[model samples]
Structures are given as structure tokens and as C-alpha cells.
Target: MNTLSSIDYIIFVLYFVLVASYGYYVFKKKKAQEHDSKAFFLAEGSLTWWAIGASLIASNISAEQFIGMSGEGFFVGTAVAAYEWIAAIALIIIAVWFMPVYLKNRIFTMPQFLKTRYNDSVALIMAIFWLFLYILVNLTSILYLGATAITGLVGDATAGTPEFQNILHLIMIGLAVFALIITLGGMKVIGYTDVIQVAVLIIGGLATTYLALTIVGDKLGVGNSAIAGFKALMNDSPEHFKMILPRPAATTGTINTPLNLDIQKWVVLPGIAMYFAGQWIVNLNYWGCNQYITQRALGADLKTARTGLIFAGMLKLMMPVIVMLPGIAAFVLHKHNALPGFSGSKDGAYSAILSFLPSGLKGLSIAALTAAIVASLAGKLNSISTIFTLDIFSKYIAKEKADEKKLVITGRYTVLVASILAILFTWNDLLGIGSEGGFTFIQKYTGFISPGVFAMFLLGMFWKRTTGTAAIVGVVLGFVLAIFFNNYAVGIFGKETWLYTAYTYETLGKDGLAHATTEIPFLINMGWSFVITVATMIGISLAGPKINPKAFMTDKALLKLDNRTIAMIVITLILLSALYVKFW
Candidate 1:
């Protein structure tokens, strides 16, 4: 009953060789630049559109999405695909509106851009926050989630069990070490190696999708046809295909408050807010301004960056097929049928589908999943190094007195320090994190800052009068809003409510009038949080001492994008609009 065979192991080994050797060669090529900080950190400004595009996708789509999104699909339906949908539009927006300014500024980290555009204080605080968030939330969560996925897919570590919990720590260590080894080679190696990583992920993901369909088809007595299987799945779980969710409600009584009511509701999924608003905050911040993912698009010129971003957008459009479809497919196969043998759990759907990969392809498919984890880990580690070296070490610790070689060396050591910290955090998290589910867990924490980050970046670029002082306040406001919404909603609002957490109804006192409710879905939480962040930023910006506009764009020339860029955005918009309409 082994999922992988000897042949599968051979394929996995060969893939490992191909990726490791190629990464090694790239690292060796950059050996001469190890002493040159810019060259080492930014690939000597030489990445092409294809490399940038591939690295963007490779770094962005990890086990979190691969495993978590599908898990959500199993539990909540295709509504989880909204993450990818939001990202597609966000990518297009970034390419057309944001990349030009970033290329002109030539910033290394997101905090650096903030520093130059705002002030040293703004940048410094953000640098420290970025490092903290990267290590604590981004890296640790990825490690835990990625390790959890590997344990489930590759072995018999059933989730939520004590045995699996122990294995999670070991897997975290393994994935952390593996990422550190790759990241030590620096950005050049990763920028190129990601091409192969993305290719493997897509090929393997497609293979799994095809195989799942065929297996379902045969299981349904359709003669092992993928088309027949897909149709059968459609027939079996049509409800799982819904993209637009309705208002979330549970029957009778708000949390902690008691009154007999006719109806009670909690939003399992926040419907309209997810599409028009909530998901956008996550996407815009992630695609437009995230340090590591955007770092992949850096180094290249504006044209290449634009092309690459658009290309990444196209890839984003396709991700639902590779990542989300499998979850939906798994739902169809497992929901009504017992064949896939997965317990109806949120996180196990993707791992359960791994049971159908047959013999030879299991290695390739597992390699793909592994690629998602390792590539994403390497990218985050590299970003952490870049931020630490350029933002923290050079700026505060060394005061820019350090030379190229010293900075590069600091970058290398930083990879070790950050990984150890992330590993430690993952170990701690293994004891018990709440069961918000993986996808929800990631977004819930992310909502803490994504909205504020997006608002600052967006306004900083377009609004001429936004002050650095205002920017600082805006960022602080975002964290405050998220803290209130996520942890204090029930306390502050007098009862649990999803969106409009601070909302009030026409009542004398804030008691349980309508009904009881559940915790808000994370996406809707993000959406409402974004609104507060935006409002705070605008209010603060209009209130007082605005920084000089020239700081953001003193001498940079206006960008003239080529037709390819225009076409890319247009097509992205068309597809994005089409989806909401079709699914709405």
C-alpha cells in the first residue's frame, strides 16, 4: 500500500538532482558576486520576464495554498478559490500601477521603500515589524503547515493525532534545514531554480488533477475516462463549485449572550465581501507590495518587471485549476463516495487525494508538493536575509559602514538565525494552535497588517500629499483594527458578528436582539479591516504635516509601458470580471 514505488523514488531522486545541481550551478555562477551586495541580493539586475514570473508563482504558492485551499474546499466548498481569484486582479493592478514606481526607486525591501518615501523612523519601525512578522507569522506558519502537508502526503501521519504532532516537529526541522541550504546559495540561485520548481509543481499538479478525474470516472463505472470522471464529480458535488457565498448565519443566540430567538447565524463564509472587498486587501498587499514575492520581480527593469508581473497574473488565473480544482475534485470523490478514504476533515482532503497517484507519478507529484514547500521557504528566508542585511544590519547595526562582502556575509548568517527562530516557533505552535483551519489561520493573522500595508502603499504611490507621520499612524491603525476585530469582536460588540463587527443595530442596548452568531470568516474580517485602515490613512494624511511629494518620485521618469503590458492587464481584467460574474 505504499504510495510511492522504487520507480517513483528514482524519479524523485532525479528531480532532486536536477533542482539541486541546477541551483548549485547558479550559486557557483554568482560566486564572483558574493562580495557585491547589489549583485548578490538582486541577481545583478539581470532577471528576465520568465524568471521573474516563475519565481513569483514559485514563491507565492506553497503548501499553505496547495494543501490549505483544497482543505477549505473539502469543508466549505470552492469558495476558497477566492484567494487565487483576488490575487489575479491584484497582480494585474500592481503591474500596471505599482511596478513602475518601485522600479524607479530601486528599493531592496518594502521597508526601504517606506523609509525613503516617508522617513527613517517609519522605515526603521517597519523593518523591525517586517522581520518580526516574517519570522513569527510568515516563516513559522509556512514551516508548520508545509511540514504538516509533507507528513500527511508522504506517510501515515494522520492529522490531529499525537503521533502526527510529534512528526510535525521533525518535519519542520527537515524542511527548515532544506530551505536554509538552498537559500544560502542566495537570490540568484533561487531566481533561476524557481523556473524548474514552478514547472514541476504545475506538471505534477496537472497530473494529479488528471489522475484524480480518471480514477473517479472509473470508480463511477465510466471506463476510466477523465472527462466522464469530471462529469460524474460535477453531478455528485455541484454545490462545491460555488464561488459566490451567501451571508453566514447560524440558528439562534449570539455567543456569550443569551436570549431565545427565532433565528441565529454565523458566517462560515462572508459572501459579497469576499469578492468585492475582503480578498482584495490580502491580494493587493501580497502581490503589490510583499517583500519576497515582489523581490522576485525586482532587479529587472520596468518593462521586464511589468511583463513578469502580468505573466505572474496569468499564472494566478490558472492556479485555481492546479490548486483549487483538486480540492473540488477531492470533494466530489470523497463527499458522497467512500473511495478516497479521507475522513471529512478540512486539511486532509489534498493528502487523501494523494492516495490515487498510482505508482510512478507519486514521486513526481510528491516532488511537486515538496517543491511548493521548499521553494516558498527558500524565498521567504532570502527575503528575511535581505531585510535584515539591508534594512537592519546596514542601517542600524553597522550604520552602512560595512562593505559589500561584510553585508553579504551578514545576509548568509541571517538565514541561519531566522530559520532557527522560525523552527522554534513552529515547535511551539505544534503543541496546539486553534482549529480555524490552515487557510483561515493564515488569513486571520495576515489581516493584522495586510490592510494597513496595502493602504499605505497604495496611497503613498498615488496621493501626493500623504505625510510620513500620517503613514506611521495609518500602519498603527491597521494593527489596532485587526486586533479588535479578531480577538475582541464579541466583547466590544456585545455579541459575535462577522463583518461590521463594531456595527450596531436599532436597539436601546447592545444585547442579543437578532440572534447568536459565530466567529467571522477571516476573509470578511480582512475586508472590514481594510476599510478602517484606508479611512484611518486618509484621515491622518489630511490632518497635518505631510512629507514633500518629491521624496517618492524626485527624478524618476514617467514609465511608458509596451503593448504586451497593456494586453496582459486587459486580459487579466477580462478574466477576473468574468469569474465573479459567472460565479456570482
Candidate 2:
């Protein structure tokens, strides 16, 4: 049954009512602070540590993770979990080190940090850059991917048909409206309501994962057991269980011939090489530096923020089980010829597995996915509103310091406009997201800026000697270097340079014809770009004052970690270590 049953609708309706009523309750409670810009945008001191933690995971795991990461799980297996697991370590670094810098400096936004540490030019450039990236890349992808995934669950509308497109548009609009309802209420509503969202998504996601595994077990002639199903998956798809993919050997095959799939997987993950390359940059930049992510903790005290981040890190440990396992299960089922009529698109793996779900449980899984998508949509819209209203509008458009009420109103308006723009771009798939694959599309585009942004933040924080001129040059150079390394480096440096090897693979283009694409793995590209950018910035800064006059000063007291923080850090490390030991 591809369509929802009456029971499914009832459960979904109850979920909708529960989230709406709770959001209303939160909005009413925080009504007094509604006019305050900081209160509206960041929730100020209102969000509890758990709320912050929940909201962090809620915002971070969207359709991108559910649909995209699971799809990757189907294609490449456990290696994709590196994004989530490494994020645990990244959150630890941010909590202990980066949080001290930001909280001690009273930094509320990424642009504000740049302005305070570097200069107005660097901040303004990045503010605009972030706005475009969020709206065009992040927001649109979330909306498109989320809507497409939900539409699959809704009914069997044939892909590429008029009805399918119509259903997709309706879901996109519905998601935008749903996010708007929560976002307009401000961050307090988003943060508190996210607790409910996280609960729903977890229960629902786990149910889906369990059912998927049981289906695999039953298909394998084992009892209908999740444990048995999981064992079957590992036994059947042993290649998918590896933490590090083996590097592809040089092989001769044409686009017409069957090329090695390892080359294709390497193009996405890049094996152990990724650990040394863009993997750290990707996680660090996303967990520590991105506005959509970091905003949840920015308003809290040092201890509260750090604790919340660590708590979120612990939650990150189990995320792959909820998000990635089903795709691996689906791969096992597909391998055993259990998934009839499967279209073979890796992105479809999660939804395909969902079809195995029982009625009420199916509703729960849909709600879970809806929770992830809505939470992320609300979070991204809020961040977009925060940047445009506070960083751009308040700083530039306002002749004088805008009143709190005016700024708050500006934020609401920004959210509305940004949501509209996202829907519009996603409507036609203007960015060719479907062709590139959602997870790869986001990672590749975002990678272009990560190297530069991470370098700027890393050096700006630790190296007081990093000059404003160097910061400005570094951002631009990093982006240019990233583009060069991704597209032109293999051409210019030759395919087998000492620096890196470009892998050739044939993938279907938009016209449905296989095209030979050769490129250096993007993560490797990012690592080289970051190295060159940092070296250039260091060289440029060396010509200036030893200590930049505007550099942020840090104190030892500000960096102190409490016992709870240390304990959580230890627990996180232990869990992460065990996971790698099992999977590696």
C-alpha cells in the first residue's frame, strides 16, 4: 500500500495538532519578549539546555539526512555515517574551544564575529555570501528534497508526470507554510517546539528502521527480527559495512562498459583520503561556524551552551542508526530481489524502505520525516531572517539603531520573503539538484566556501597576528582555489600529480545519457584549497603587525571546562571510538 490509510491520517493529524498547540503555548508564554530582536531571533536566555540540544539535532537532520544520507547509505553504506560521527567530535571541539571564544566575546552571529575580529568589508562580503548560499543552496535544497520525499509517501504519483509535479508543489508550499507558522512565533517557539519534533522524529525514524530490518530478516528466511535483519544486512552487503572505502585501482572501461562502482563511491567519499582532506573542514565548518547551526547555542551562557552542544554530540552518536540503517537494509533487500519495482535511485532508498512500514507506524515515520524537514526549514528561515534583518538591514538600511520591535518585524518579513524565494527556486528544480543527488549536491556546493570560511574563522580566532587584509584575501582566495582544484586542477596539474589523482566515472546527465566526468575528489580539493589559503593568509599577515589591533582577546578563565563537560566529552569520545573500532 503506497497510500496512507485512515489510521495514518489520524495519527498525522494528531501530530500536527500537538505541534501546533505546543507552538502556540510557547508563543503565548514568550509574548512579552516577542518584540525583542535578540529574544525573537536567538531565544536569548529562554531556551533550556535540552531545548538547545534538541533544536540543534532537529535543525541539522533534515530531508538532507533522512533522504540524502540514507540514499548514500544505499549507495556507499556506513562510510556516509562519517558525517554524523565526526560531527560528534566537531561539536566537542566547538564546545570546549570555539564556544569560549564566541561566548566570551559576546558574539551572536557569524557576520558579527567576522566584523569584530576582521573588518566591515570581510563581514559584509560574507554576510551576502552566506545569504545567497543559504537561500539558493541550503534553503532551496531542503524544501525541494523534503517535499519530494514526502510526496513519495503521499501516493503513487508517477515520476515526471503532471500529477507528480503538482503533488510536489503542494507539499513544498505546505512545508513552507508549516515552517512559517513556527518561525513567525520566534526562536523560543522553534527551540521549545523542537523538543517535540525531535521526539517524534526519533520514535518515528526508529520504527521505520526496525520495520525495514525485520522485512529484510523475513525475506532472508530468518525470523522477523530487527537484530536478525541487521545481521543479514551486514552479512549480505559486507562491502557496505566498511568505514573506509578502499581506494579505486586504475581500471580500463568505457562509458558503454560497466565501470567500477568503487570509483563512483570514491568520487563521493574518497576513502581514508577524506579523513585527511575536506571531512574535518566539512564537519568543523558546519558544526562550529554555520549560522543555522551555531545560532541555537549563541544566546546561552558558556556553561549552558557547552552542555547543550555536548548533549547534542551524544545524540549525534545514534543518528546514523535512525537515518542510515534503513538504507543499508533496503540495499540488502534489493540485493535479495525483495524490493520489486524499485527504481534504483539511491535517494529513493529511505522512502522505498518506508513502504515496508505498517499503517500506524508508517504515519509515525512520515511525522518523523516531517518533523526533521519542518524543524530544519524553520531553523534555516530563522537564520536567513536573522542575517538579513540584523546583519544586513539593521547595519546598513537603518539610518539609526532600529527599535527592537522594528527589528523583530523585519525578521518576520525576511522569513516570509525567504520562504517564498526558496519555494520558487525549488519549484522547477532550478539548481539541478535531482541530477546531482541531494546529498552530493549540497556537500559539493557548500564545499566551495567551507575551506575559506573555516580558514578565516580558524586563523582569526587563534592567530591574533592574522591581519584584516589577509582575512579579506583569504576568503576570496579560498573560494577561487576551491573552484580551481575542483574543476581545473586535474586538467592543469595532470591526472596523476603527486598532489592527487583524478578518478574518471560515467554518470547519467540530465539528458539520460552517460557522460564521462573526471575530477579530483572534492574533499581532497577542499583540503588543498584550505592549506593554500591559510598559507597565503599567513604570508600576507606576516607583512603586517605581529598582533592585529582588533584581534579578540581570550582569557584562561573563559576557557575553563566544568566536570560535567569533561564527563560528557569522555562519554562521546568512548562511544565514537567504539563505533570506529566496530566499523573500521
Q: Provide the RMSD of all predictions against the true structure, rounded to 1 decimal.
A: 5.1, 1.2
CA-lDDT, candidates in order: 0.75, 0.91
Superposition TM-score, candidate 1 onto the true structure: 0.90
Q: C-alpha displacement of 376 in model 1, angstroms?
A: 0.3
Sliding window of 10 residues with minimal summed lDDT for model 2: 250-259
Model 2 over residues 1-584: C-alpha lDDT tens digits? 25799899899999999999999998998778879899999998877889999999999999999999999999899999999999999999999899999988888899999999999999999999999999999999889888988898895687788888999999999999999999999988999999999999999998899898889989998878989888888888899999999887655334544355778888889989999989999999999999999999999998999999999999999999999998898888888888887888998999889877888998999999999999999999999999989899999999999999999999999999999999989999999998888999999999999999999999999999999899899999999998998889878788888888888877767698877888888999999999999999999999999899988888889778888899999999999999999999
**Residue 226 alpha-carbon offset, candidate 2, angstroms:** 0.5
Q: Write the per-residue lDDT of candidate 1 for residues 323-429, one digit (tens) a residue.
A: 77777777776755744557666576777787777887888888888898889999999988998899888978995499988998999999999999888777857
- Which residue runs does candidate 2 get wrong by more than 4 Å? 251-259, 510-512
